[model samples]
Target: MMALVGPVGPVGIDQLGVYVPEYVLPLDQLAAARGVPVEKLHIGIGAQQMAVAPPWEDAVTLGANAAARAIAQGHISPDEIGLLLVATETGVDHAKPASIFLHELLGVTANCRTLELKHACYSGTAGVMIAADWIRSGAARGRKALVVATDIARYDLHSSAEFTQGAGAVAVVVSEQPRLLALDPISGVFASNVYDFWRPLDRREALVDGKFSVDCYLNALDGAVADYRNGHSTPSGALSEEFAALLYHTPFPKMAYKAHLRLIEGEWRAAGRNPADLGPAAEQSYRTLVEPTLGAARVVGNTYTASLYLCLAWLAEQQGRALEGRSLGLFSYGSGCCAEFFSGQCVAGSAKVAAGIGVADLLAARRTLTVDEYEAFGRDGAGADLPVESRANFCRFAGVREDKRLYERTGSLAQ
Candidate 1:
């Protein structure tokens, strides 16, 4: 419950960029292939489609494309970026940091600091917080920080977690007087030693206790929101009354809905009302404050580290001008497990910045893959070391040679 002490001035996300692979798998196809009811996937988990990365497209490539898109769309010069923070659960190498690869691919200057952060799905928020703090501390030296949250969520092909798998990246530029979302330096955090979800060094797919993870997520949400209410003082209203929208780290879209209900129930109890009678009320509140954030996530599945930011992007895109000047509450949860609740507000030019990133265009561009074709492609990065022709993507994972991961600039934003 310790406060994140700082100047707490106007420093936050200046621009946002996103990248999803061109390939997509509709969850109905997967449900049918698995002999499961499609409604269970569509209604139970709230997933429709998921982005599928080819073997050659790993975290490094996905992150690089996203960062490049940010630089290009935001009209930011790579030399002006002083720090590069990449957050991912899927790491390509044991020794090397993915940020270094992104630095080279995005043409960042030699003077930049590069590193990677991992804490399941929450590392992306960690990077953003660190970047904002760096700017606040004057450590950035008038240069912006680029925080890239990139991941390929993988699970056993025929397992229960399979429909939740997706791949994507979200890149944000943090700096002074940001044009997109202006972040508050204060944050509420919670952590515990729990193994609700984890992946070992030897395995490509993650292990998750579905029911336990849901419980953990709800508990962490409670802890984080309580801490947030304690430390926050500037916004002079109740949590539900102060914020225009709420976003959560979405492993799947339904998980977010559950978190909202948990928050609403807590609010109901605190107001001396019956929590059991708040179901319809909670659903209505969720529709107004949280549902807009899930459009991209419903289609993309679990983006792991990029999940929360993906929601922000979706919200900005869906609400457009309506979001300007409105404040938002965001909760980030990662299992093994840590959680944080933070605040941000949409700035004057938020709509333009969001539109420039073109989130809708990215989702509309994906090519649907057949279930058999997806299975043939596999979850492991099998043909990653082989050479292939460059496509219209901004960059690609070319091949690995002599124990080095190689990448190439295939095209530009215009293509």
Candidate 2:
């Protein structure tokens, strides 16, 4: 659409697609009933809203929606799509790659390379990294790569982290010499110790220490930032004071706030700079984002792999073109204690790319579920059938006779 201001690179997110189901669990309501101030959950996890997925929305359905929209908008033909990737711990099948289902729903070419990746929340970024390399290699014969990061964040009912649960997806299309901002060749990544979150196949909820997870986020955030700063040369004119917008891996919105403020504090103290010297714009930008982050994310909770990208979607909506053409800082952290620090330029098309979602309409269209409905939805998986509310047609349950997977086609490939 002539919106991309610069030459594209192999690694940049050319088009981004986001999908959050209509149903949401508002945090203030939860807090009021829990007999505490809204700030309790609000301040505790930095989440104000969390989106819950009923049976109708699964990783397959949500990821398909996001990926389909991105590809269609980018004018990519299904025949030219060589890689179909679905990265999530909440994958549809333990044995089968979720990409197969995506292929069926999106009508990707039969010759595609389909694979499912798992590395906690980092799986999505991992998919992007590898797909970039694949595109750069050009061995796929003019084919582009499509990666969908989808997940549902669930903790056992009544767990402290339970309120942070969310479901969503972010789709990215990577191609060679494309339309979008170019990615920098250099990036920073680090793997710290692991202890925060993990769940086995049999378990439905996540297990973790909230303090430990928060501690990991702060340490990883600082660690990655320090690594990037130490190795890279800064840009001229306010390298110390200037940055476009800082987006962090939002396990929850409040957690990101705590980490962001801590980063600002450390940055100011290290430079002997007055925090207020930067003026209200910088502070307000960060505040406007992180303050309502918890509230905004409380309803959607944590979408795991899609968490950070989902934050980018929110930032695009609120920040507008002010962030365009500027350097955007990002921190991505995963549960296994993996973290990466990178920067992306906000090209002219940033807002336009983010403008495709019908978030308000989707929110209005969802069917809200009570605690009982949520429990039923959460518990309906395994060698069994999907719950009554499921609307996943492409992979509908057909009562397992043995251990083999059987899929029922719902519709044509929409990719």
Candidate 3:
């Protein structure tokens, strides 16, 4: 348990921007390609569609685009950001941090301290906490921080985890007097060395122990939630009823569903109620408090570090003004493995800021790829050599050549 020491001034997300690639793979198409029933993916796993990044998009490009959107939408001058951190598992360079490229592409001040954070998926939340603390502790001297979570979840073809692959990025601006959710200073974190999921340096895709991963995720959720309750001095009964919404990292929607069941069951058990008898009540509570948070993950699949923030973005956009002053509980988990439980209060007008990000339109405008096309794209690195028209106002991965990664900025530089 770690709590802010100084007078915690209001510091939280001031703006959020998301960039989902322009390609999508429908779960039905994937099911047919894998010779499996569509219901397995559609209902069992709860994945509807997934975003696919073209060759021109990687973690760096996605992060840069997302950060650009955040800066533009928030009307934040690049010079105002003193720290820029990127969280990712699929970084472009092994030696150079992804934030270095993003810093140049976004045109942040040269004086900014930029780095990459990695802890599987939990790195994003870690970056958020670091930024908030930096501001709260006066290290930032009123300057803001930019934290971007960007990743492309890739799995070996025909692997069990294939259907869960997706790509996207979310950029959040943190500063005092946040327009979005105001974060609490205290957070509950639990970490353990677990090998449920991982990728070695030589492997291009992840290797996962599916069953063990699920168990780890659930156990981490339970532990973090318990720590959170104990730290806040709130008993299980009150903890369950206090939150207006609960958000969690969604590798797939079904995982989140199971976690919600655990949470509801635990609460009931603590209150001396029969968990079996509260089935209908639990379902209703999940539908009301948890289901809404999965909307984006259902469509975009697992975005690694961006997973939870994407859910928060979706909630903010969908719930809009109605979420004002409501308390939101968030659980973040990363493989090999760390988990944190935290809470935030939705500020007034936060919904409008979320809605302004235009994530829905971005998803709607995507081009769907057939199974064969998708496989071919994956085979040739998504046509990395093919020439594509460059948008005038976007950041893109130009290409890699001679073992050097190149990035291009065609848009107006951040001021």
Candidate 1 ranges beyond 4 A from true positions? 1-9, 233-237, 384-391, 413-415
lDDT of 2 by residue, 44-141 (tens): 66567668776656777778777766766666777878987898888767788877887876778789999998888878877877777776655656
List candidate 2 segments past 4 Å from native: 1-11, 32-37, 177-181, 235-240, 273-285, 288-298, 317-320, 379-401, 406-415
lDDT of 3 by residue, 291-384 (tens): 9999889999999999999999988988868899899999999999999999999998887787787778778888888988778767877337
Ranking by lDDT: 1, 3, 2
Give the count of colliding residue pairs in each prediction. Answer: 0, 22, 0
Best candidate according to TM-score: 3
Model 1 lDDT per residue over 36-154, tens place: 99999899999999989888788988898888888888899888999999999998988799999888877889999999999999999999999998999877768999999999998
TM-score rank order: 3, 1, 2
Each model's TM-score, in the order given? 0.95, 0.84, 0.96
Model 3 regions more than 4 Å off: 1-8, 390-393, 413-415
Model 1's alpha-carbon lDDT is 0.88
Give the Cα lDDT of each candidate: 0.88, 0.69, 0.88
lDDT of 1 at 25: 98
TM-score, structure 1 vs. true: 0.95
Clashing pairs in 3: none
